[model samples]
Target: MKQMSYMINQRYMKKLTCCFVCIFLLIGTVAAQDKEVKLKIVQTSDIHGNFYPRDFILQRDAVGSLARVYAFVQKERETYKDNLILLDNGDILQGQPTAYYYNYIDTVSPHVAAEMLNFMGYNAGNMGNHDVETGRAVFDRWAGDCHAPVLGANIIETATGKTHFPPYVTLERDGVRIVVLGMITPAIPVWLSENLWKGLRFDDMEETARKWMKIIREKERPDIVIGMFHAGQDALLMGGKYRENASLDVARNVPGFDIVLMGHDHARECKKVRNIAGDSVLVIDPASNGVVVSDIDITVTLRDGKVTDKKIDGVLTETGAYGVSDEFMKHFASQYATIQDFVSKKIGRFTETISTRPAYFGSSAFIDLIHTLQLNISGAEISLAAPLSYDTRIKEGDVYVYDMFNLYKYENMLYTMKLSGKEVHDALEMSYDLWTNRMTSPDDHILLFRDKPREGAADRAAFKNFSFNFDSAAGIIYTVDVTKPSGRKVTILSMADGTPFDMNKMYTVALNSYRGNGGGELLTKGAGIPQDELKERIVSSTDKDLRYYLMQYIEGKKVIEPRALGQWKFVPEEWAVPASKRDYEFLFGKVQE
Candidate 1:
């Protein structure tokens, strides 16, 4: 039986080798059609650690493997019969099991992701916030070994102005001169680790893009111009101007460009924007992590004075416009097989449902994960977990390490703050207010909106309930009942030893520097705290990459069961619904009218 099985395996191996050769052969012969140079461009945005279908777990039926992407691209090219251009919108590194397991180890790095990208035909890539999360040294190495160009126009080293990554590149495919320019989101301060960008300077995206626009126009003038930007509609093209104006504000302002692919905010555009001059500048963006691919077919028109209008057969430009494919998924699995196994061992199951609810006011599944980790890592009596609600739901069976990092994506440092009960409550209120405000104004900033509150303006009362998650502070415990008004949510606050929060005494609370410095405006606003001053304040971001550190720790652990920290509860009554809006609960939690 063993001999027979071995022979069968050898035969299968030969067949697979033949298939691989055939794929390459087919890729090589792909030529521009007679009428036009039909080319396909595949782009992905904000793919944070969601590489495999079953996450990093080595599961077959799960979706979103890069191999599937490759297969899809191949199939598209076969049908379209066009030249191909593959562009990544950035935020590629540190998104999936690949970034978590191997990229962190330095044993395997972004080169691994890039290599897979290159083997599968990624022509050009850009820098994402998460890419910088790994630090410059690792990024530099990854850039050195990359198969495609890593691009950013404005990002320059502080001590030296040399770019950390390439700004743009011009390529020729199917007799069409295509110029691709790169721009990363300018939100460096908000998303990146201070250490990674300490001395570096990332200028206004438009200024940098314009400067490159002229350089490329004069030096590398091409037939078609395309922008590969990490900044998206919210940052740049918020459609109509609002309070904050950003670089994409200049996308239309730039001359000598045809189409632009955008990222950063990870929003799919409503449609292509046309300049006042009547030039339709095609623009496209796919939602993060290869969920959907945007396809655009470019056709040019030119004529002499005699011929009024002529439809000149040009290039048929294409990108990812569909779903997961078996071929792409299978190849992606084989390449990252090492990473797949290293992250997907069973982490145990949850007997209860975990959610990101109460994210607006009190605590959540996302918040619960944070506190539990901080308490465990720092061994602090009170661990502070800053609320950054993304995706949630921890169920039975194998949970990938990649999922763990996504729940706590930031490379933030954990610090402890000593505050009185009042101080803690005040800070909680402030964070809650920010959460509510962010939800209310959810256009360019919030791509995720599972939590929202209706008070509209600055309502100091968002903090009526100062409930701490069981995981929010390990050595501490608290409960909140929505039956009471907003501020009085917390009826009891006590230490693990059963000591209540005393007005005269102080307690040590652990949290991230972003919270301590009061980025959330909760503690910064001094809301509800009728005190003379803040007890103590200290700020620390991160030294080693926190995301990478977490990934390394998970591989060694027996299990990482994420659970719901039973802290806050909903009011018995439902909130009033605004006739102006749709299902209000989808945005804001059910408000008690």
Candidate 2:
């Protein structure tokens, strides 16, 4: 009987052991199947209010619209499933008629950017420098309306010294964690007025990044870390003393990020930077105006519920090939119509057509119109202005609000500052240095230098500096000698009224707010003035935007004609006149008569 009982016990134990083994095998199989997870992140930066497929400024079919970008995002989402997240790297709250209308005109209603971003279901967004420029009321209201987190680690609150916006956001997908840290360039104090950036302070990118990286690694323990920077790839001093663009430096210095994305100066880039641990980190910049998007794919491997391996791949995806989303257009069709009506209103009439293309080589009606308005409105002795557009033209006929957008590209205010006669001369010298190159020979290109050119290309001229920064002075008689060096290029003859312009005498000068804020270094570097001392020199400032003043000025007249002051010209006209004509014809396909 004992032997039979022992046999029964042994048989029961064998059956139990086999059942446990089968259960373990099933668990192992399931774990093996679910060990790997893939995530896709798409980034859009420097969108600059490109909501529609058409350019309201030019009144033409514009490339790189947000409607097309939405379609691309939809396709990517469909291809990658819910494992994908959409992010905007900032600079979305300003730049176009759509933005300007919703921002200033219809202030009571919801902002266009907030509505669009919420509708598109963006996961996160960073605060750009331009976003800060929109003033606290506009940006703060927009930030509140957004469904996703508006982040800016470096944008600190002056009262508490803490970030005004949320520093970072954490997302989890299929047991894998993702941490995204947002940062903006620390040059806001340099470019903007206290009214625009009140109660906020911006910090250095690399320092802020290092501090957050350590905290996130220890606390969140994320499987992937992403840095969203509203800055350019190159580390350059943009606002005189401040290094506004520093995206590349943060990626190299910060240790834990799996990927970094940036935009501000509007350059496209896609590459990798390895961390101290020898792990490769992907970095991408999608340029500006919604032209491109940064797409990233990350593969994370886990074993026994612990992350084992990770890999990331990033690229800049062009949105030009993508079609506009009908759904998006339909969603905001009414808003578009309203903006169209707003921009289409007739303000005044022009007797003759004008082009800004000639403004780069010499003074023209395009920049001179702005100068005339500046001097007339501010009632200053001298006026300074530049061509805000490269190749915009308005025909002889009725002028509309849309034409004003082409006339002045930014929402800058008119400023009158106190400058000495010597300082004004120095400013003109710097302006011409950016405008023209020293003519070593008459055969050399007069205004532009094109290093590489297509054989049959109609336009081969290229500028060393942006054409918008090529400033010209009105109300002052001056000559720019291309034969001389930079500082000695300008020879001021006298004031336009033939008054003796004494070097020791102080003169009130009318100019745009951008130049007064040291935007182009014409004041700080060229005029040998300190940046901090700029506000003290402000004799007067327009209460409204320069565009608004221009519109009011033209509307008050009802019949308007824009012409060049022609107070300043390039010397050696025998060489310059013909060269200017040839280059103008090559660039704009129009012969200068």
Candidate 3:
């Protein structure tokens, strides 16, 4: 009788276990159905023409190859019911070799690069500040050939008050509306000059977002709102350790925004940001220049009358951990191998030492070379070249065409603008103030050059690179007194005919369009002058690019030589900041307060 009771208890326990399994399976089925509404978003930021693996300067091993990205994006889209969209946050041109041109490449158009990206498939992107460095023409070319939408909400043609590129794009996926609003950094005037952005203005970002989001929400009523912003990430928790930067500023203030995709700071951030109204905006910015990509899948819940919670799925890995396309890698390797020989060579050395002292006046031969090139080729009456090159690897007497190109990586137009001596004086004074504030305060800074100085010292690593006493071939002359302080540093300004500078009279000064429209504060144009430094009416200003001019100057031959442009001569007597010094505070003499 006891044995019979034990068998009966075992049978009852088995029945109970079966009942629990059935209930569990039913719950899991519902959960799976809920998650099936998830959306996949594939993002790329700061691609900046990094269509291929490792660029000229960034010679990292196994750094890049779009094959991995392409395959991954395809697989993800396929997995997510073909609902995936790829986006570039910003800065896709001028950083790499592409269907574009920079001062770094010798009339070499990035044809293969353009085709490669077209094949890989990009849906849309924002216009980075560096993208403007390509100027309007190349932008036209790249856009004409691209299969994606290049967007910018605030960037405008000042003449028309209309957006130069599309402000936003909306795609209807099944029963969902995904709206992607693009926003570029308003810091264009800070990084690039006014000349490159002729007839353009970057509107207030906050205001633009408010207006666009409102319009899109009201008219299209997109099911999802995504902001493709090219902004830096926030500071690290304790130290400046890597942290994601998506100016949640827009997310918090701008209503109806669902996600913010940010770039420009070169950080990989994938997380949920809480706005002021207690709404969650998904933000992601993969590492810059094709180092990494962030994949995020999203799901929305709205069971009640009011909107409910949204979810972010974990990032799917591609490229970095897993290898990229073998064919793409093979092609990139072959071309890079050929280009490496030229970039790696050290040309010649400086017999005389160089300097970048007194801030306002000229200091380095690198500056002189730029001025000489601009002046010699354009044959302008006067030309001014600021120190655009950074990280001078050229030891004394060792300079290569590659080194020169590396220093000046942008291709901007040369222009001759009419300006009174007073305006020129003001610009120089501004540069002085910037230099002084940069050196003394060190902490309080705004200008790009003042902040990090590229290689920790733009003027130092860039300016004092090699030495020369080059004569100005552009019919311009100036003198500098190193003994004087910055405000009163400049001396004689002898013209093409050795005439004195007339402050009240208009003089046609030749310079890159970037400087003419005030790329740097040192070159701001006056109120009446054309906003674009390279606007037509000035002689030869309406013509070709600096690279083309350089090509014509060289005539397909080796012609770069050490020549000093006597645009400004500095006195060796006064003590100025040394290029070798890292600390800037000591460089600026304390005020007599």
Candidate 4:
């Protein structure tokens, strides 16, 4: 009986050992299957509504269209397959006539931008500051139409105190959990009118990132975390409360993020920054207008359903390599034709030709036209205007709706603010300080130029005065003496009607909403006007944008005549006369007739 019992026990033990071995082998196989996942993240940011390769404003072929991006994405999709995720970093809902048409004009129809993005299969998108500038109705509608989640983790709803958009999204691919959190620059409240973002509150980017990272790491235990920051690389403080460009700060302060994509400032960059955890994290910015796409490749390793190791790499993919996709064009061909017809419609006629290039030198019909319209509409005592573009021209005769876009590059509203004549002098002084350099001799380069010529390029002259900020006043006669120093450069002589300019007397100044809101610091820093008081000084504001008023003003007149007010001039004609001629030819490559 004992021998029989020993034999049964030995057989039982052998069977148990075999079962354990089989279970171990099965666990090993399952672990091996879930061990690795390869993911490719493709991104487009600051695409300011360039769905096509054509420049709707210029009516010519330009770079950085969604068609070009589609071509690249399609090719990349083939390589990445289901493991790929596509995203847009924001600033898409507004910009260009194409977007403006769909945003405000064609309200009943399906949004073209959203439709295209959905059709192309974008996994997610972030709301840029400019996107918020489009107002709640426009953005809310656009976001509702997007098939993918449109996220802004920091955009809090005032009533609910919760995120207006999805704060974060988690995707599972081959057992690897990937979490993406989206945040926009909190400077929306700083730059935009409060009415535009009335229901929403923007939180600091870095702070938002930190809070989300903790939650995602603890609850989701994500294999990888990616940050889609619709902010810039710069750490510049905006409104002294938050950083406008806080991507780098987030990367350094917030831990557990494997990748961060930045936008808003429209700079192309890719680098690695060590996180607080001392692990290298990749940060990339694809720049603006669909010119480039930020590509991130993440390699994750897992063992027994747990992540063992992970690595990520980032790079910017240029859109130039891929031409416009025929497939994409076919999809949006009808909408494209509609916009073409809309922009082609004649708005008014110009009495004579005018170009913005001349505005940089002094005053020209181009900027003066804007000044005339501002002064006429606002009925202000004086006007402040600037050349919005570097090299845009409107020829004589028929002008289309498209021409209006070139005339006004941005959708800035009209603002009439109260400023003392002394304050105006200080503002113009700062404007010319950026406009001109001290000229000791006639031969010295008058226009701003590069310190060194770029290789293989002809000695290209660049401007220290970003033509957009080269403000010149109308309704007030002033002299910018190049020989004088910055603070003393602008001398206000009298009003356009020859009334004596009084220093302490308050005058209503008509300018763009951007300037009135302190864009370029011409009013706040230069004029010594307090930033907080800017809103109080506003005498009038347009319900619609200045561009809209400009179009209406032209339509009413039928025959639009734009000419230089000649209210301001560069002094010391012996030096100014020749320098203007030389610089104009150098910059625009056209002879001044």
Give the TM-score of each candidate. Answer: 0.68, 0.94, 0.66, 0.91
Number of the top lDDT candidate: 4
The TM-score leader among the candidates is: 2
User: Which has the better TM-score: candidate 1, or candidate 3?
Assistant: 1
**Could you give me the TM-score of model 2 versus the true structure?**
0.94
Q: Write the residue-wise lDDT of candidate 1 on 354-472 in tens digits.
A: 45444443445556666666666656556656544332444444555545554555555555566666666655444333333222221322211223331211112122322221123
Q: Is candidate 2 or candidate 4 better by lDDT?
A: 4
RMSD of 1: 16.5
Q: Rate the local accuracy (lDDT) of all candidates.
A: 0.55, 0.84, 0.57, 0.85
Better lDDT candidate (1, 4): 4
Clashes within 3 Å, all models in order: 29, 0, 19, 0
**The 10-residue segment with the lowest total lDDT in model 1:** 236-245
Worst 10 residues of 2 by lDDT: 452-461
Residues 1-593, model 2: lDDT tens digits: 99999999999999999999999999888877638888889899888889999898788887887898899988888867778899999988777899889778999998889999988889999999778877888899899989999999998999999889999999999889999999998977666666688788888888899999999999999988999999877687755657767778878777888888888767677899876777677888887777778888888998777788887888778787878999999999999999899999999998888988778777788888888888889999998888876677888899999999888877787889999999988888788887787888776567755565322111222555666667888888888888888798888888899987788789999988878878778888888888888889988887667899999998999887888778878779987887777777766677662
Query: Which residues of candidate 1, in runs, are more than 4 Å off?
Result: 1-39, 57-60, 79-82, 106-110, 236-248, 276-278, 301-334, 345-366, 379-383, 386-391, 395-411, 416-427, 434-509, 513-593
Q: Report the C-alpha lDDT of model 4 over 1-593, residue by residue, as the tens digit.
A: 99999999999999999999999999878767756788899989988889999999889997888999999988988878888999899999766899989888999898898999998999998998778777788898999999999999999999999999999989888888889899998877556777778888888887888788888988999888889999877687745465778888998898888888888766678899898789898998887888788988888888777888887888888888988999999989999999999899998899999988778777789999998999999999899988876677988999999999889977778999999999999988888887787888987656656564332112122664356677889999888888887798888888999999999999999998778877767887788877788889998899888889999999999998888888888888789888988887877677673
lDDT (Cα, 0-100) at 400 in candidate 4: 93
Evaluated against the true structure, the overall lDDT of model 4 is: 0.85
lDDT for 105 in candidate 1 is: 62
